[model samples]
Target: MVFESRGEKVFRFAILIVLGLLSVIALLPLLSVISVSFSSGWVVDLNQVTIWPKAFTFDSWQYMIDRPDLWRSFFLTLITTLIGTLLALLVTAMLAYPLAKKEFMIGGILMVGVVITMVFKAPIVPYFLTVRSIGLYDNPLVLIVPHILNPFNLIIMRTFFKQFPKELEEAAFMEGSGYFRLLFSFVLPLSKAVLATLALFYGVVLWNQFQHPLFFITDTDWYPLQIKIRQFITDPNEMPFLASRQEVNYNERTLRSATVVFAIIPVILVYPFLQKYFVKGAMIGSVKG
Candidate 1:
């Protein structure tokens, strides 16, 4: 094999160094959160905790578990992530399929409008008013309804569909398969990679959604985990702890870190399963057409 040039080797080394630094930077905060969450109240207060716990304790996590309201909010977030992801994938795929075909009338105009919306988002007041007018305010549907179609995700999926093999559609048509049959039976089965990717995207968005619930959902019972965590961070005194204990004293930092880790765990758990599909889906969906 030929020896690499000095410049090429230096460039490769630099790229590796940059990527390693980025990885560390991304992971540092998460590690700090977990470490701080586990550390003793005083340790956290002193800001000693970093990559590892200084005086290890589980008081904050225990306190978090003791709160029923936090659990309820977690369940609400879970429900929204699951249902919202599924609905978004289905709706986005449906919208993208027809738009992928050039023969579809109004496809170009609709795409232009979608791009415009993406570039210039609507004002929050109008968005809230529209949601209110539709009776979604204070409803659980507030989390699921307004966020079903993401324009960026839609465009990515449209590109994926546009690059799909036309021969398959032609063969299906020749076999007398209808549009729904062709879509649901054949297209969807072949589109699993993109579907999984978009599902993850939607799931993360729904799970991390704070502003929508903050505005539309007034009832404390309907608050998602993020909103609950926001309240905790904003004012730890308002935390609805179950029972008082003298041995374990938790401060806002401890509570915030625990809530943050709790909220993050689900998405972390989910990413691994979909990791295999992510790169392929993103590349195919975004680069083609």
Candidate 2:
């Protein structure tokens, strides 16, 4: 390594210190949430609110585990995330692939349409009315269908596909391979990084979706985990033993923290595997013409 001047060394050290501080600041909230979740009760004393847990307890986790409704909601969330991400990927790929081609006459028009849709979101009431009219109001389709092809994701995928080497497509065409065959055999395999990135994006969105289910789904059985957590936090009266002073006051704060911890665990678990792909994909997808 080249020797650094004193000034350069000082500058580099300053930058490193700033970055370290920023990282800790960013991580503080997550660490606090985890601490609260594992804390014995909701009203953690001010003295105990440190980086490390004052006293550890699994009561929050135990409480959540014993709730059948929470489990059901979690299952619903998983199903919705899986189905929504897969569908979103398919629809995004289909729309993006043709748009990626310069030869496609209507590609520009379609792209403009997508941009317009992204810019001007329809009012909630009218959208809800339309969903009800289409008879998808209570179904899981209500959540998945509305977001099947996110415009930003479409744009990213289109950009990624456009970056593919023209020579590859030309060679495939020379071999008499059709568009679908080329897409299936060559384009898709090469685009896995971008696809994985989009999948994670869509999956996270689906998993965290709360408003759609809150409005469209009336049945308690169909509520997603987020909705369930919201209900628990907001409507403490609905929870058993909360009305009596003889029982331990369920710490809503602690419960909320636990719920958040549980909610994020699935995404956290899968992120490391796909993180490499995410960065590569984002770089490829953000390239402008």
Candidate 3:
């Protein structure tokens, strides 16, 4: 076993302390939201909540649970996350395969074109007009289509595919398998580490997407959870519980905290399942083979 010098041990201890503090700092907002969600509305209004509930209650959660709009928005966001992750993974993998191949002549040109998008983005107004002109203005495809492939993700996947084994692919071709067959049967199944990591990344981004929906979607029925959460923050009148303000102990702050808590819960729950693959995938994809 290797032994550490006294200085090295001290430095390691300092790094550990910093990381522990940073982890707590990262969780502070989430803990505050949970605390406020359970606190009495009056205590919340007074800004009395720190890390613990002043007067613990479940009124806000019950109110949010009973609202049909909340459930509708929640399911819409969930569906979008699932569909977006799968489509993005498929498109990214398919496009990366040929580009990873040294034999594909135009692959260099195409790779340059894709990299250019990473460096430059289209102007907002023109982009808006272009999307609208194509008939995606107010459609639900506004959510799914635009985010089908992220350029950075595409690049990472290309790098991963470049390091893939040629022997397996050659054997598959000898057995009469085509490009699509090799990709579906061999590449994808073996690339689960990277794919799972990217899936979690895409899923989180789609789930928390707020700005795009506001710009593209005006139809109330098509609104996702983020839009609904915005309403909770800006206009408390949109919350149904306020109609009976005199009867219930819960107020606007309590309900808003509850909504915020609900919005982030799904992502937190999903992280652990994919976490085992995250570090390995991330490090391997970041560097050349």
Q: Ranking under lDDT, best-scoring first? A: 1, 3, 2
- Where model 2 places Cα greater than 4 Å from the true spot, the runs are 1-16, 42-47, 242-250
What TM-score would each prediction reach against the true structure?
Answer: 0.93, 0.90, 0.95
Q: Pick the candidate with the highest lDDT.
A: 1
Residue range 77-116, candidate 3, lDDT tens digits = 9998899889989998999889899999999999899989
TM-score of 3: 0.95
User: lDDT of model 1 at residue 28?
Assistant: 97
lDDT of candidate 3 vs native? Answer: 0.89
Candidate 1 — which residues are off by over 4 angstroms? 1-9, 239-245
Report lDDT (Cα) of residue 69, candidate 3: 87
Q: Considering every candidate listed, which one attains the maximal TM-score? A: 3
Candidate lDDT values, in order = 0.89, 0.85, 0.89
